[model samples]
Target chain A: MSDTTESKRLTTAQDYASLIDKFDTFLFDCDGVIWSGPKLIPGVREVIAWLRTKGKNVLFVSNNASKSRPMYKKTFDDFGIDTTDDELFNSGFASALYLAKILNFPKDKKVYVIGMKGLEEELDAVGVAHCGGSDPAEMEYMPAKDYTSVTPDPSVGAVLCGFDAFVNYKKYSKAHTYLTKNPGCHFILTNTDATFPSGGEFYPGSGAMSAPLVYSTKMTPTVIGKPNSHMMDAILASKDFDRSRTIMVGDNLETDILFGQNSGIETLLTMTGVTNEDHLLGPKKSSTVPTYIVNSLGDFKVLVDESK
Target chain B: MSDTTESKRLTTAQDYASLIDKFDTFLFDCDGVIWSGPKLIPGVREVIAWLRTKGKNVLFVSNNASKSRPMYKKTFDDFGIDTTDDELFNSGFASALYLAKILNFPKDKKVYVIGMKGLEEELDAVGVAHCGGSDPAEMEYMPAKDYTSVTPDPSVGAVLCGFDAFVNYKKYSKAHTYLTKNPGCHFILTNTDATFPSGGEFYPGSGAMSAPLVYSTKMTPTVIGKPNSHMMDAILASKDFDRSRTIMVGDNLETDILFGQNSGIETLLTMTGVTNEDHLLGPKKSSTVPTYIVNSLGDFKVLVDESK
Candidate 1:
């Protein structure tokens, strides 16, 4: 809002639509750009409908990996929109796909996941065998329950730390002790966010909690979330989308903006979730910047109509 | 085995007893020193018994905060050692205690935790109310999980990150988003071990996974683990222990030796855990060197007797 005229790069939704028409690739943030909280912003469905009418290719890129593709698909359906699993770009799906490609993560690999069902399904889709400590019979899947309980056998080759309800100091301490004792093991984490939005408040995320492990182990995680090319690489390999023709849009800077930057696609910023223009102009703004900005999806229709 | 003649620091068990008699307080690591992989290390029980016989004060300092004092007390009882809740020091406990002391963490203030039951107990002990999303059924207790699933509500004055199983990309992304959104929120963590000795091969610890959150938040966690002095502070606050008459023993360099150095207590390095003597005598050895070194707890006992 400050000094809007002083910038070399201030763009409107129309500019973004023209770029999308030219490039044929689109990426978007979920929370702020398309919707806020659970309610879809105005005109988003219509704008997408217009884009589909124009034969423009689009990929919804989100760093949010909490939900599965099926859930997202359902959400879109509920909103009177059409989206296929192949057309979606989620951090969890991308992460699993990449691990399968690069690390030869086998369908038979006994993956002990500490995440929601979304991640578990992704692993299942990849034919990766996994279990959580909660599954009574699968309790053996967990090696250490942080610092409190040692549930799984400590001899497993890898320990995957994700989002879970049972995270605690005892569990973490146990996990730390186990990992320290066995330095040769593999440690995989989904993302490093400190907190997330729910209902009307924020909650601590994996990033906030996982930071300590990074310091203790001196090992960087094989991050499978946005801004990293692992998910993009997997999406590109799927052949359902063309990389050069795709545009990425989102509200967040690090993941949503950087995803577009990393993928060489058009980026759009919506004033809906997690990020705003002030953040984009702030010092922490990464090397990646969105190609366009719109007040809301309702405004985006105007851009699409003008482009036509 | 290295050239002992050239070493300026004492590097034997006998050297340890003399140093122990000169110190007033003692700290010990839980994982490698007291027990490794569910089994107590050789002669550790005896050495501790000998310490008690000599009227030396002892403190069990662990970076793993997943467990509460009562839990440690049970473990000690299993190990044939008598201990009280105050004698057991964990990062989670210390972090809670320290936050309560400095910030006057309000009894009604909403504390968001990304940890386990032990962490919950600690927060409760300090008279703090917590909110998390993991268990909606616990709504009577504010049924909130960590801050990962929700937005940073202004009502949340403090955010605590610890070991969590539901640590995922969305959570990580959300945590980062919230911290960036609200910079005034107090950020706290249990420990920074890169990897702890999990029962199996090494996996990611809290420190490694929490790196991104720490970076994004631009806040350094007030560590409650060994070497941070929070545990020592807790020990000193107890009526039974005298700070000037205690000592510390462990195998890890950073946790054990560093804890002793930081707390102004004598330190003894055991050759049973994460670090070896080579590291202590290597080029990386700082002025904060251990006062003595021993091969095992058996040798430590002999040194103690000889000093007597």
Candidate 2:
């Protein structure tokens, strides 16, 4: 809002329609852009459906690594919006894809998962062997002095972390051991989101879960979610999409808008979630400015109605 | 090392006797200085007794927060060393003393503790009311989505974190809520030691336990242990000790030696524990150089034998 040429506030129906025509592919951030905690943001369904009807490619790119694509598809289905597993690229999928395709991980080696079932499922989907995640044995708290039984598997070539509800001393200890002892072990994290808004309150995110390991091992993991290029690489590698003709739509300016700007794609900021107009115009305006701004995706319904 | 005049390697018995005569008060770091794990370092007891025979004030200053002063005193007793609780200063005691004496916390407000029994005991010793530490209800793993039951007491004015074995999502969630919601709520951490050597292997320390909360809250706690002035302040306030005439003795250069350097007191580094000669002379040489270096505290036994 400091009169930046990149960000133009859309105030008219014609403005919305013209912006819609500029992009052939649309990427949406799940939490704030489309919905917020179990309910769809007003008119998001209509906007997405309208985009699909117009032969525009729509992809749900989320930083939520707690759920796999199939699990995410259930949420879309629950919201009455049509989405396939392939159309959803979440942090879990991005991490799995990055390991399997980009790094070309050894088939004999396994990934030590310090996350949830969703992350493990994605790894399994990509035929990447994994251990430690959601394992009942690892979930139990072991005394700090008792390290006789805490042994690392030599086959673990990578350690991947995401959101795990059962994050305990045992898991961190094992992850620390593997990272320190295992030579050439890859350290990867889905995202470093400090907190995620949910049910009218903020909850600890994946970053909080991975922090203990980072502190103990003194090693920063390769983050693969929003604001990092690994997710973009995974999306681009999996599908053919024109970056020039694509625009990112999200509510959070830091993660979502910045991700778009970093990926060299146009970004549209929506006010239905975490960010607002004041955020862009205020002294604390984020470094990454969106190309366009709208009150909500519901405003685009008027554009769809006008086109009809 | 690096041509520092402060660090003089003690070789001859005359050098050891000269170092002993330089300082009237001797501060010791427990883990590496006095003992390693469950066993006492050789001749450490004789050296301590020898120092006391010369009318020197012996105080144990450790970053370990897992035990209260009395509990720590038991370790000395177990090793056949005569010591009183008042002669010991640990992170747990430092935190409580800082809150009760330095901050002069409001009598009506209770402190929320995210630590073990030792931290709770020290808080109790200072006549401070605290909640959450070692509480069975708080130790249970609550689903990330469920925050309905996790409530903060309105009287909570401080959040203290230490080496908590029962650390879980619920405790972190409640602590975050108290920190964000409660007005003037202070955040305090015991020590930021990444790893502590135990049972012949390094394990995650109190800092690792506090990392999750640090990440989620995005707030750095006032650390009250080695290398921080608060611990030094706590020790100074409790007793009348002349900094010019005192010397800190320990094994770890980063924490123990740095603590002495920050406190304007002389330090002696021994090779009996975590640090060695290479650490002082290598590329990773610590900024805080000790006043004297010896192969072990047992080397001081030569001076005692010569004096006898």
Find the candidate with the highest DockQ and give its number: 2
Identify the runs in model 1 with alpha carbons over 4 angstroms from their true place: A1-21, A99-111, A123-130, A133-190, A206-219, A240-245, A282-287, A303-308, B1-220, B239-247, B272-274, B282-288, B294-308
Residue pairs of candidate 2 with colliding backbone atoms: none
Q: Give, for candidate 2 chain A, the lowest lDDT window spanning 10 residues.
A: A143-152
Fnat by candidate, in order:
0.33, 0.62
Candidate 1 has a DockQ of: 0.25
Candidate 1 per-residue lDDT, tens place, B1-308, comes to 34343222445765665666686567777776787777888767777877777777777877776677787688889978778787777787777777776677766557667666777787777777776524434222112344334455666667677765444434444455555566577777787766655545555565655665776566677776777776677555543655566667788777778888788766677777777656867677544567666666556666655656
Over all chains combined, what TM-score does candidate 1 have? 0.70
lDDT of 2 by residue, B178-293 (tens): 98878789999999999877667777889999998899988878999998978999998798988999999999888898899889999999888889767877887667678889
Clashes of 2: 0
lDDT against the true structure, per candidate, is 0.65, 0.88
What is each candidate's DockQ, to 2 decimals?
Answer: 0.25, 0.67
Chain B TM-score by candidate, in order shown:
0.81, 0.95
